[model samples]
Target chain A: MAESEYILEVKNLCQHFTSGRGRKKLTVKAVDDVTFSVRRAETFGLVGESGCGKTTTGRTVIRLYNPTSGQMLFDGRDIAGRMNRKLREYLTSNIAMIFQDPIESLNPKMTIEEIVGEGLKVRGNRNKEDIRRQVVQMLNKVGLVEEHATRYPHEFSGGQRQRIGIARAIITNPKMVIADEPVSALDVSVQAQVINLLNDLKEEMGLTILFIAHNLSVVKYFSDRIGVMYYGHLVEVAKGDDLYQKPLHPYTRALLSAIPEPNPLTERTRVRIDYVPERDHDYSLEHPSMVEVEPEHFVYCSPSELERYREIIQNA
Target chain B: MIYDRNNLPEELLNLPASDFEALYQEDIKDEKFQTKPVGFFKDAAIRLTKSKVSIIAFIIIGIIIILAVVVPPLSPYGFNDQNISAKYLPPKMPIVEKLGIMDGTRVLKNRKVSGLSDTDRYPEGSIIEYFNVVTAKGQEMCDVRVDAYMLAGMPDGEYHWFGTDYLGRDLLTRLFKGARISLLIAFFSVLTNVFIGVVYGAISGYYGGKVDIILTHFAEVLDGMPYIVVTILFMILFGSGMVSIILALTITGWIGTSRLIRAQFYRFKGREYVLAARTLGVPDRTLIFRHILPNCVGPLITRAMIAIPGAIFSESFLAYLGLGIKPPNPSIGVLLSDGQSVLLQYPYQTVFPAILISVLMIAFNLFSNGLRDALDPTKRGEE
Candidate 1:
């Protein structure tokens, strides 16, 4: 990715977890040498199966988890693993996150007002009146009324609650948003609504986004560029439409093929590539490594396979 | 109850029976179901109100407080002054009498005395003396003043309402005075404990690693020492004054609160909302107090209610052992010790104070248990 065009850059980020007993300890490489960037006004989707460390990568970029190694630059300032008071306030004001589960993501006990206004309270040292005014405006912007401010999370529908969550995330006027499966928990109809809302806000605010999900079809529709992860390694990265049309990596190809096609005849022609589920297999050794298969396309392949893949790409 | 033709418009109330039944059921459930108001503290308050016993106990305590503050000053007698001459008398009983009718034919009889006999019966039926006595035939008579031994240091002519102690202090006055000290000790000790415990536990739980380890070690060290021993050490160091007792009681009281607050913090700190706060750049203080503490406050308040009775009982136990409040400053503990000394001769002294202590302690315990039931967020569904 071009450095100047990026609003956020994550470089070679690694997060490791150690488990098992005594000398027989096993280490799980959660986010191994993952690299991607969100351009100034673009949606960057991260796709993988469960346990692919996509969530871990998003968390690390926001510095919720201190990266074991590597760097994350938010607007050209390295934020990974280094948190100060000012940096925390800066992050709160500049970047925000929308979570997966609406029920769990919002605190059950707080009112809509307290929940949405919390970001502002944390970011700006404003008086109470100003916070309330801003909270009301944000709530109205998210299609909630003034009366809803006093109501609790349980009072609202799942979709409405997610909107409240979005209102909370955006209340601080963040420049970038890390939406971690923001719509997956809602009903299918509600999912489209939330996605549309996010898209509208993205355009209106000129925001950068890191949208993470397990669904390839959803990301294909929503993201500007897509990065495909297979067991903690970035297997491929390309323009969303290009990747959907002509995926270069085997994992990406299998993922694209799995998306249910609308028409029967063309769907039948779509290949079903049978392989081990990447989430179940331990892919630690394959990580901390990647090969440039083609211009702007990277894959984490073994040395022997890397040469073969490079040859194929060069001929193409 | 709409009857419509089969060709009626669909909008003209042709709903199915099941739909009507479902709507009725929903209405019924809505009427009966308990709903929690949003916001942690308000929800907690609603929950807390559900405990009938806590509410009653709180009222009783409030009445006691009013009496402690208002009624004592209204008393005709002071709390401390001793009338030594009237010592060791029994509880006062109201005396009613009518002099024998003396017409012109009957000689007028003086009902004041049977010439000051040790026997409880006076010579005439008109003069009533209230005392418990053993007759010469060995029957117990509670109506007339006869046995001199039961009267203790009673002078020849006086009406002592509710007999005095060995030092001639009024029992009622002493009881009230003792209440003042015992309750003060409970309140002050609880204040110190909650302050220390909430701060200590919150910081340890919030920061959780080196600070937690260090605090845990400190709490463990304090926990290892016996409560009485700790109290005695403080008493020796600071002396057995009200301040010293408060200091001693609070020294060990906070451990329980710390454990409770720490548990609450641990339960809530790792939740998604807290992590979200951290990601949003909400400072540590706001996260700890605004987000995290409110989650924990329900339990903390409940635990504090439970701790008050414990503190009161501890002070009482210390006083009963003669290590608590000293003589001249009547705590229930000191009164209890005094009662024990006189229990064989005057069981009422021991019985009244002991009963009061037990009643107060039990009331507080029931109240605290009710608070715990009401304040727990997990119990919201039940409410």
Candidate 2:
């Protein structure tokens, strides 16, 4: 594949944290050897249960949290480990992130103009008029009026604040964005509105996004490709429709089964399969690694389980 | 999906022109619009004005400041000027005398002629009389010639509005001068402490881990020292003066504000906006000072206001203990100490300084309370 095809690539990313003191020290492997890539102008959705390292993976890829060991290539340049001033500046200008909680994500004391224009100011734009012009333009693009520029974040609703958050993220015209559960804290109606707005912005700006969420249905609706994470490991990766239609991993099947169907008959009769890793997989002998079951569909399983999974796909 | 007016859909083009005009018509009401936005400080000031008690306190403080500035120069008697004859004179208001509220005394301008003729010894213009004098040791009687030239203007006698002190200095002038020194020390000490505390605390709290740990420990060690003992040590080493007293108070004064600011910084540091600023490439210095510090202003201001009374009280206490302002230059504390010896004979000496200190402390505390309530956004609607 051409290097320009993908905007961001992560290979074997690891992030560990140590807690407690002296003899009672503990190391938590928050993100353990996760690998993924986001192609240009495509949304790569990472779905997982809470505390399964999906958010941590997004943060580490953006370099908000330093990776213990990994190679994160943004535009074919390595930017994972210790960064120099030039590389940091490059990363800051080229990539941005949208946090989960809309209310807490914005500074309560700052006006909408300052919050959105902060990036330009930090990048050394001294002209106030130019900054305001760009900020107003971005605000209008995010479905906010010019009057909202001077208002504080506390005055806005959750959905409106998220739009403000989005405006702030893309004001510098970054190439890629990492949206960490941006709609999880919003109302159901507002969630759809924010998601649609994000989709529209992605198309208009030609932005590649790493959308991290715990909701399987939302991920299926928004992403072109999806990766399922369980216990700090990426267990499966496939095209969004393909993964939902034909899931090979037991964990993926369980996750898909949990999504509530709209039809009354199916909703009443659907039986959710419980996936217990200990009961299902006998990984004591050979630890499972990610293996390709078919073209563009990968699963975490041993050689024997891989053969079984492939036979099941072939039979179906 | 581009919709040009000329290329409108067939169904929309078939609609009548009158219907299109009717769809846009509605009531147009005239209303004034806001030309500018209100800032935080402006909003706080507006809210502060609504509280009646705070306004009264503000006016009282204003009067005291005016008195401190204007009264000292206009007074006929200097703060240190003395007359032994006028010692322990009772208070007499000039306005009361002019109003004829009390009878004025008349003195005879001649000396008592016991062994010689009255005209030869009195020199024709002098009045002889026996005068009573009281000393710290005992009371005595003395014969003196009262010259009319010395008693011309004061038909009754010299008037002392707040009466004269033991040194026969005008108590009113001394009180005003004392207020000037006390208020200045409080103002400058609080300003110094807040400036140092905010900077130190912001740096310590913004950068956590080893830096925070070391700085916090250092602050704790300083806080552990007894304030008065440290103040006395500073006084002994540097000697008692305005600079020394201010230094003594500031040494430990900044600890409280620094701790307060540190906690606030710690709380705001984890907030997502701060993280967003960091990811946006804002420098650490800008993030700490510009982004994080402004949010802590309300609490900082309230804390500083409350600190003033404490500073004033400390200065007065030190002066009362003879380690404050020296004797000749009057401090409230110095006046109180001076009055303590003659308190049984003359209660007015102690009463005036006591009332002034109490009024000042009460006013400052009430004003601070009002400021805290006014600046709190949660309390806005309650008013």
Candidate 3:
């Protein structure tokens, strides 16, 4: 990939959280040695089952949680480790998160206008008239009327609330948006609507997205490239179409096989993939060494298997 | 349960006809609904209204306050003056009985020596004596030796309305006067404590982490200290007075309130709205006072109501030990202390004040309980 094309490059990002009753400490690797990058105006889909550290990876990349050890380069600037107050503020306004739960994410007392314009307010864009105009315009773009802006979050339907959440993320005009399962909470029909809204916004705002979800079909349509995670580790990374047609990793193949075929006449038999319940033994302290198995395709494999996959891909 | 506008409960949607659409628009659109109400007054009022018991208690307390303030000044007798001759006088005891005691003249003549000579009747000395005495009339000496304790002759009246104490002071007047003193101390002590607690708690909760640790430790240390010991220490330094009692109660009283406020602050400080405000660059003072403190009002007001009765009880306990309001001032504790001897003879003196105190306490207690229920935010489903 060309150097100028990459907006965010996450390298070997690892976040370990300690959870235990007392005296004894147990470490859960929330995000383990995960590496990926988003090019300018490009969407990178991160797909994994729940508890696979997908959300943690997104949050850490946004600096909500300081990673145990890793490097994150945004606009070619390394912003890992303890951030200064000004730097933190800059990051908040520059890259925003669209949380999964719209009801919990939006404060119960605030009006739609305030919720949508919260990003602008946080950035100290205090001209009330300007904020009002911008918030109304953004709400309109998200298919909400100006009157809805004055309403409380509880007054709106779940879909409308998600739209408000989306408006809040976009109001800052951030270069990148980390949408963590943004539509997973909505109904299937509403989910489609939100996904389409996100796609349209991505194009209109020219925003790079790190769309994290479990829906392979949605990710296939939303993202240019996809990364599959299992047990806190990013196991495979490939182009969206290429990954679906020829999935290299066992986990990705299982995940893709689970998606139902829409064509009734295709006579497809669903493939059941046994998900390995990740035990502490499943991940050792020693990190899996990653290898470029093909052009623009990376996989974490055992040291001996790396050259084998490289040769196989070369021969193919 | 999602309320379809058409199926909304009447009580739930009891907004004034004029405000229906307007409030709906504001409720649906305003950021405060998402952020939480800015000030506590609205929510506090709402919570207070919901508690039926609290409202009743409030009414009872209001009546008690009115009685305490208005009833005493109208009384004819002074609270402290003693009429030795009228000692041990029962309430509504006929004038004939008082006249008969005076008619004998012998009991009055031997008042100092004859009264004190008896061992069982007068333990210390006969300040007052109750026994039958003969009158000067030869027909049938029927003058009664009324056990009336007083400093001087009884006031020019038919008889004692509530019986006199050992000092021959009017028991009814003293009770009323004591009620005033007790209630005042309780009111002031609670006010002072709540003020201190809110400020202390807000600071501890808002700053959190290291600052929280320090304040929490301070609260813990204070909490661990025996309240009785503090009262004694303060009494020794300041001597027994209303001021001393108030100071003692309030000094440690605020610790509980502070702890409560601090806990509330911790709960609310990291909420999404608080962080949102911080990001918006809202001032720290506004965030703490406008955003966080309102959430605490329900608990604070409820606690404050309950604490008043507690303060009054504390003052009474101190007075019972003679470390509260001094002589010339009446408190239920002081009245109970002074009435121990006369309690056997003229039980009304002791019984009346004791019962009043108990009833007042019960009323206040019940009211406080109701207030607490009313002020709970989670239970405040109604307006």
Task: Report the number of the highest-TM-score candidate.
Answer: 2
Better of 1 and 2 by lDDT: 2
Which tens-of-lDDT digit does each residue in A49-94 have in candidate 3? 8999998898888776788998998888777868777667667766
TM-score of each: 0.82, 0.85, 0.72
Q: What's each prediction's clash count?
A: 6, 8, 38
lDDT of 2 by residue, B1-383 (tens): 01123434677657877675433222221122244666677778988999999999888888988998887789888888987656655455666746633222223323232532455434443453545432323433334534432233333455667777877788888998988988888999999999999999998898878888999899899889887788888899998888888898899899899999999999999888887887777888899888999989999999999999889898888887878886688878888888888897677788888998899889988899889988886764344
lDDT digits (tens) for residues B251-297 of candidate 3: 78999999899999989887755654554345578778766887687
Q: Which ten residues in a row have the lowest lDDT in candidate 3 chain A?
A: A277-286
Between the candidate structures 2 and 3, which one is better when assessed by lDDT? Answer: 2
Ranking by TM-score: 2, 1, 3
Candidate 1, residues B1-383, lDDT tens digits: the string is 01113344666446766665421211100121144445655655677687788788878777766656774566555667677655665555334212321110111232233343534443333233554343544443444333232334343344333345787777766776787788898888898999999889999898897899999899999899887877787788888999899889888789888888888889888887887777777777887778888777767777777777777788888887778786788887888888788888666577767877777777788888877777776776454
Which window of ten consecutive residues has the lowest lDDT sum in model 2 chain B?
B24-33
Question: Could you report the Cα RMSD, in angstroms, for every candidate shown?
Answer: 10.0, 8.3, 11.0
CAPRI classification of candidate 3: incorrect
Q: Which stretches of candidate 2 lie over 4 Å from their true place?
A: B1-38, B94-159, B380-383
Candidate 1 lDDT for residue A278: 61
B164: Cα error in model 3, Å: 7.6
TM-score of chain A of 3: 0.91
